[model samples]
Target: MTPLPTTERRPLSDRTFGFLLTLPALVLFGAIVFYPLVGSLTTSLFEQSLVQPGREFVGLDNFRAVLDDQFWPVLWNTLVFTGLGTIAPFLIGFALALALNTRLPGRALLRGAFLFPWVIPGVVVSFAWLWIFNANYGLLNGILFRLGLIAEPVSWLGDPDTAMYAVIVAKTWASFPWIMVMLLAGLQTVPGVLHEAAGMDGAGVLRRFWHVTLPHLRGIIGIVILLEIIWNFQHFDTIYVLTGGGPAGATTTFAVAVYDTAFKGFDLGRAGALGALWLVLLLVLVVVYVRFAEREEQS
Candidate 1:
């Protein structure tokens, strides 16, 4: 009998083959992310003027200057906006998710309607809210005036005390729908049998939610909250359009500060420094997210 011919195989090892498969993505990441990151870090070490020809080596002076002058107030604004933006939307989304998770009339339509804010462009959302919060002819003041809630038009975006809150409200409106969608997906994964068992044991609605619902949703909750915080920390468009970082910089988060420093202030070095610090904070959150995701996958 003739021996069967053996098929020849390529010389590449499995690991090598896998690396080759990922090479394109790695190259893309290098170009789009790593290169710019390195550029920003390098620029942070120098003083460069947009109008001038040369960059001066300043070491960490750029960082020192930012830290000593504008950093604290800006950081405070960022924290307030990010914190309120994240928490308010999260609560509203969670509530909506719970309400819609039940059997209800027009559930699908309601869900679609709730997603309007999330699907709209940030600029458009900013402008819509801009009109809503307008000092003169805004919907908010109009309603308030008719109801006798205010003696006069209130400038929601013009007052430092209220600008951040108004921005947060807009951010919340745009953000909650996404959170609702995520948590709603998580809610679907929950075992209905557990809920029934809890109900059979005479657990109240709030009790079952506190015990069964929350425990089941803990993983998704952490992920959504972290992701929202990261996104909010870098949020700029809403604040920019609605308040332009303020009547007095009340809404200037890190993203806005970086833009204003680079283009408006014409200080590339300081902008780079601010960006580097922003990158660090985001990196820390990313690391935590990666670890949490890994843990979730393992469990």
Candidate 2:
């Protein structure tokens, strides 16, 4: 009798196996993110209400109305908030990262302490800052009055001129630690030989940092700033808690505007339209960030 031949089983390719592993995550993302996104887009094309049962197709009227009504001011406020929120935290975090990168006492403890603000829940942070900026008997006002910086307590969140800045301060406080952690990690990756060489070449601290340190950190810095901008663009908790979109609509960013339009005004269509525009802005930033990240990886 002839011996029977056996067939060998082939293993799955790496790409296929990886896809199989990620399939659940992909399905979850589509269900959670893509589903709502599609719903929002569809809703933008129709006039609908949260309370009412009927809906009417309005085409682009919602977008046109949003553009005609307070859109410019809201867009301006969002830009200001995003710009300041990103820059202020980045500067503070960079400075802290540099300082903490040295051989200092209690460095580990200090790093942990610095992360407190970032780890705190946004709602709690918002309320804490709200008290700090309160018109009467607030920490900030008390300090200013004691130091003779002001004759009286200042209503930081109640003034249109200062409301946005007050919220930005809170945001900066909460955001900087993340930046610090990232930059600190980047700093650790900077070669010691480069610094030693730069120093031996008569390069001062500032010069070394500008030429050597900064170049090493340029990629990380760009990525961090982009992430910050994207986060701040959608930040609603701190601003809403601190200013409630303000004394004169001065702090009405896209996030707050969308919330107010949908919940407070009960105009789902307009809210969806505003949200659609906001999504476009965020998508642009995301695309830029993805390209930048890919370029960084390739280089």
Candidate 3:
């Protein structure tokens, strides 16, 4: 006797189940993210002073005014700060990850030591660095004096020339551990077989790292770099606490500029306009990055 034809129905796959489970989260995001974004964009098309009773629709005037002469310096400062800030943290973090990846005495202790900077509150970090970088009698200056490296104290946060760099250093110090932890996790995911194969092929340490480890970490590095760009560009807390975008407005990025324009100047329209521009710029960058990532994945 022949058995009856068997019929089968597949259960919900993991991807579709996950998407369904996250539908509520997606709705929450639409309400929270898109709603405010739309509101801010609408606000940018008007003249809304805090002192005024009414708003006037001025079309692109707010944007035009935002792009006036003073905009260049702020934009340049933001770019430089973001570039240096991103690069320094990544380099330091990658180095830390490499160092800690190998087994050594007190390795766990060393990892925790690096994480201390990251766990501190931003305001506290700012204040701590403020004291350390003081032009007179600070630890750094005192150390320099003891070493006889400088005849005079250097005004790290006081000089416009050095203020942005100072902030970058503080931010890098605070942020590097985040990258290190992430990279270390990625390193653990790399296959040990690959390294053994490379070594068997007569590869040196540098060669194995370049060819085996780096390719394994390519996706993680790309994600980390892109995220750093977004976070560093929008970062406000440390800079706001440390410099307040001062020392001749040397550290005023788009984020700081938005705060100053909105709160200090009380020009909501202009602030909103600047914010809209910022949103557009970030969105463009994200899209380009996503396209690049997709292409890389395809290749």
Candidate 4:
């Protein structure tokens, strides 16, 4: 046999070339993500006024002020919104996903239709629900009136009591499909034999799901729920467009609060502080997820 041809490796300079290749992306990341983060953090430490003569360094006074004033309520609102917005969808979407996973008629059509709400533009969903929840000439009110459910139209989006829920309902409608799709994908990964085994043990439908299905889905569910929390925590347009944090600011989420504090209140420092706090919360969750994923992979 002929001697094997000698192989020549690429030059060590390729490492530097690879670094240069990734430099653009690093620059872009700094420009968009990291730079703004640093800017926000720096701005939060100063007393920044939108219309005053100059900025002053006030340390954490802006944060103190924010906390002293409306921060508690706003934080509560944000938490509630995040919690309900995440939970309702996770549950309903899981159910819907489970149903869709079965051998049922119109399975393909149902799956496609579930995706419809998620695919629709947020603005369109907001406006559509705005009309549906409208006090006058809205479908929900019209149907309720016809059914004799109420003597007069209810201001679903106007009332402080109902505004958040109304927005939440729209949010749920838009978001559940996302969870459904994710859970459906997670469902696919679960071995069919597990279900068959459970069935052989005479496990009922709910029992099988609770025991076999949920165990496999727990990790995915947790991740999706956390993601939903993050999304809703930063959610802006829907609540803003529909309610504008109206009726005594019942629907004011963290994102809306940040906007109001910065633009409407003209208190950039406080807004920055609030934004920084929000960022820290999100970062913690991200770190947790990354570590968990790494550990899972290692295992």
The candidate that wins on lDDT is 2
What's model 1's lDDT at 159?
91
Candidate 1 local distance difference test against the native: 0.91
What lDDT tens digits, residue by residue, belong to model 4 across residues 197-238? 999999998999899999998788877887787788899988
How far in Å is the alpha carbon of 197 misplaced in model 1? 1.2
Residue 208 of model 1 has an lDDT of 97
lDDT of 1 by residue, 90-156 (tens): 9999999999999989998999999999999999999999999999999999999999999999999
The 0-to-1 C-alpha lDDT of every candidate, in the order given, reads 0.91, 0.93, 0.88, 0.88
lDDT of 3 at 221: 90
Predict model 3's lDDT versus the native.
Answer: 0.88
Candidate 4 colliding pairs: none
Clashing pairs in 3: none
| Candidate 2 local lDDT, 1-299, one digit each (tens) | 34334335536655566679988999999999999889988888999998999899999999999999968999999999999999999999999999999999999899999999999999999999998988987999998899999998888889999999999999999999999999999999999999999999999999999999999999999999999999999999999988889788999999999999999999999999999999999999999999999999999
What is candidate 3's lDDT per residue for 32-78, written digit by digit as tens?
99887897788899999766778999999998998984467877988
Worst 10 residues of 3 by lDDT: 1-10
Q: List the residue pairs that clash in candidate 2.
A: none
